[model samples]
Target: MTPDDERFDAKTTVLIETVGHHVQEEETDWFPKVRDALGRKELQEIGARMRDVRATAPHRPEHPGSLRAADALLG
Candidate 1:
């Protein structure tokens, strides 16, 4: 849908708000529990692996609209 479309804008707003809430809860509540469960050593290992994977990830989107879609979902 076009950026000017009301329906698209409404959906985008809702999606962004929902994602913000999820991130807040994850940071304040879930992440601590997960960190305790995973422990520092395992978390460090995961972080290193993630850094390695991210180094290989595409910096730019592959298609015309992919960047916008990725921003909406990943931001």
Candidate 2:
């Protein structure tokens, strides 16, 4: 099986919902223009950016006041 299948486990329903939302974003704001304009290299760059964001995503909820108190607690 693929890594995506393993990462998004049965209990992680929210991840599926989040992917649906991202698909909607692409449909509304990106796919039409991108389908015509962007090349494979540009698409690769976008994928790389998304990977970087996922790698450094915030794991813990940040409190309102402190800037550094509740930073990304992820590994």
Candidate 3:
């Protein structure tokens, strides 16, 4: 591969690994702590509220901040 292609592959690997780690940490660590703190009844209520919000929420983010962050990282 060309140097540019190799650089892109490395960057993609880092981005994917970072996202995977964040998801794993959030699910395996943070979510359990939140569940323990909030309990099931509260979580169920929150889940219902979340479902309602998700039904109406825009599929894409409304804010440009996320794009800016990604650009800052990748550009």
User: Which candidate achieves the best TM-score against the true structure?
Assistant: 1
Decoy 3 TM-score against native: 0.63
Write the residue-wise lDDT of candidate 1 on 15-62 in tens digits: 999999999999999999998899789889877866765655556777
Q: What is the lDDT of residue 14 in candidate 2?
A: 75
TM per model? 0.67, 0.38, 0.63
* Local distance difference test values of all predictions, in order: 0.78, 0.67, 0.75
Q: Cα-based RMSD of the predictions, in order?
A: 6.7, 10.3, 8.0
Could you tell which candidate, 1 or 2, scores higher by lDDT?
Answer: 1
TM-score computed on alpha carbons, candidate 2: 0.38
Q: In angstroms, what RMSD does candidate 2 have relative to the true structure? A: 10.3
Considering summed lDDT, which 10 consecutive residues are worst modelled in model 1? 66-75
What's the residue-level lDDT of 48 in candidate 2? 78
Clashing pairs in model 1? none
- The C-alpha stretches of model 1 lying farther than 4 A from their native spots are 58-75
